[model samples]
Target: IRAHHADLAKLLTSVKGVGPTTASTLLAQLPELGKLNRKQITALVGLAPMNRDSGTLRGQRHIFGGRADVRRVLFVAALVGTRFNPVLKAFYARLLAAGEPKKVALVACMHKLLVILNAIARSKSPWSNEIATVV
Candidate 1:
């Protein structure tokens, strides 16, 4: 991958939690990562929350129906991110403090991590704590 997609590999691995395997998986499985908007990217990876409400019934928003493989890779990445990535670590803590369940917060962190990666890819930039925080 580095021989062919050096730029992408470098960009993806710039993030603290995204190792070579995670970056490669993303590059292979989610070719649209940099090309799409945040919403599109999240939906593609099954990280976007879907509304379950009906005409007269309010329901919780849940995620479903996207690339399970990408989602699985992101789950592992997010777990590491919560501990090592300062931005993600803070985000996870904040979510937990706000009463979100551990799993829910982790999912949210995954969503956020994807968004940050998408932004980085789109801008052709490497990850930085300041830039990631803004994203």
Candidate 2:
């Protein structure tokens, strides 16, 4: 989208989990979100932790899966958000209080950020940090 639409790129990074890397990655993976729900969104961003278990191990869900490239970028954007974005800061703190692991909480945050990005794309709006609070 950003190739032809410089504005979307400018708008995207202003969102929580959308840095240059994630903004680009999302454009590639979720080429058509006109049909994705939150679940599909999660899978695309590679934030969906899988549940794998055997007999003795139980494998307590973790996030060693999903698209590594996308995950890499989203994770970085998520870290930035936790420190800088107000809504995400609160959301991260809430998830931590709920006893989720730090990594998991961050992933949850990424999921939310991705959803917002999708909405922006669908709605044909651009983002600006100055106006982030209004959203």
Candidate 3:
């Protein structure tokens, strides 16, 4: 995989917690990563929360229906991110302190991680601390 096109994969793996497997999974499963905006990318990865409200009753928002493989990989990556990646670690801690459920906070981290990855890919830049502050 590294021999195929090393730069993009290398750029992605520069992020802490995203290993070669996750990077390749991203390359194969999400060829559109760099081409789309945050909302579009998050929805594509099934990380965008969808509201389940009706006319009279408000329902909880939940995420569903997108690339399951990508979502799964992101979930795992986000789990590692909450421990190792500084920005993500801080964000996850903040959410937990605010009383968000562990799963909800992890999902939020997944969303933010994906958005930062999308932006990095779009810009053809290696991972940086600045991406952490975004979203």
Task: List, residue by residue over 91-133, the lDDT tens digit for candidate 2.
Answer: 8999999999998898887776766676676666665543344
In order of appearance, the predictions have TM-scores of 0.94, 0.73, 0.94
Candidates by lDDT, descending order: 1, 3, 2
* Local accuracy of candidate 3 as per-residue lDDT tens digits, 56-127: 999999999999999998899999999999999999999999999999999999999999989888888888
lDDT of each: 0.91, 0.69, 0.90
* Candidate 1, 2-97: lDDT as tens digits: 564778888989998899988989999998988998998999888999999999998999999999998998999999999999999999999999
Which residue pairs in candidate 2 collide?
none
* Most lDDT-accurate candidate: 1
Which clashing pairs does model 3 show? Answer: none
Provide backbone clash counts, one per model.
Answer: 0, 0, 0
TM-score attained by model 2:
0.73
Worst 10 residues of 3 by lDDT: 1-10
